[model samples]
Target: MSVVWYFDFISPFAWLQWPHIKALAEERPVTLRPVLLAGVLDRVGQKGPAEIPAKREFIYRHVLWRARQAGYPLHFPPRHPFNPLAALRLCIAAGSGVPATEAIFDWIWGQGREGDTIEALAPVATGLGIAEPAAAVADPAVKAQLKANFEAAMAEGVFGVPTLSIDGRLFWGSDAHDFALACLRDPDLWEEAEMHRVAHLPVGASRL
Candidate 1:
């Protein structure tokens, strides 16, 4: 079975996890699906890290620290929480393959550039042979595909970006990469008694 990767250009965490996910292509097919992070947050009725002041500061520092420790380049885009619709649509227009995803991620996180608008994304679009970046990304089909991606992610119970769906199981967050790899190599890991126990654990209280 193929791996389904749900990501959003708006997340630095997604950028951090991208390399490892890209490497998975060597072993198995990885489908790169771009969905709007805001849409997912809205669907789950939660605020983004950036929407919380203290959490925003913490996330920026935490990702930088993680990147430094991992030897991955880390650069914040000119702005945080910028609209990523254009970039997402551009990926759809580019066929949503590894190269296109890599270039777009590198453009935003690798180079600390602005990527919210068509003009800002022209370079990446041109590189991908999309002469009219605006027209290509703004095409009705491309827009619909992005919406469909978001809907599909929701249907799969995806609540965040950088989520990997393997064998119908979801492993979320960059921190969970190891667990995901472990599960991938040994699918029976989920069949352990303790795994089932935790999966059905009852909640004692509700936040509301």
Candidate 2:
């Protein structure tokens, strides 16, 4: 069975999880699914961590720390909270695979490049061997695919990037990387009758 990694380039946490998940791909099939984090946040009526003040502060610092710990260079984009629509669309155009996705993430987070617009991203795209990135990003099919991915993610109960889905269960956030790997290693971990029951339970059932 393949594990699905739902991601958005705008998220530093997603960037952090990329290497780990890529390594996991060696052991199991991993599908990289690009979805818009903004759309997910809008649908779930949630806010990005960087949108909140205290969390934003911590995120800036922690992301850098985490990057160092992981041995990856981390640099926040020059502008915070910039639109990621164009970049996301470009990812769709680039096949949404590890190479393209890693290039996109590196351009924004690793190189500290600004990526809010097609104009700003064109050079990065060129460097990544994606010919005509601007035009490809605007292609109708690419646009639709990104939207479809977002909706599909929502339908699958995905509320955040760096989310891993295996056996129909979602493990969210970069912190869940190890747990997801464990689940992949042992599919039987969620094979019990109670696990199946939990999967089908109504939302907020315990609260109700």
lDDT per residue, candidate 1, 34-139, as tens digits? 9999999999998988999999999999999999999999889989989999999999999999989999999999999998998999999999999889889879
lDDT for residue 93 in candidate 2, whole number 0-100: 86
Candidate with top lDDT is: 1
Off by more than 4 A, model 2: 191-208
Look at candidate 1 and give me any clashing residue pairs: none
Instruction: Give the clash total for candidate 1.
Output: 0
Candidate 2 residue-wise lDDT, 1-208, digit = tens: 7578899888899889888888887777788888888889899989988889999999889988988988998888998877998888888788887778888888999899998998999987887777888789889999999888887798899988879998668999998888887777788877678978887887764532
TM-score of each: 0.98, 0.89
Question: Model 1: how large is the Cα RMSD against the reference?
Answer: 0.8
Instruction: Evaluate model 2: give its lDDT.
Output: 0.86
lDDT of 2 at 121: 91
Q: What is the lDDT of residue 94 in candidate 2?
A: 80
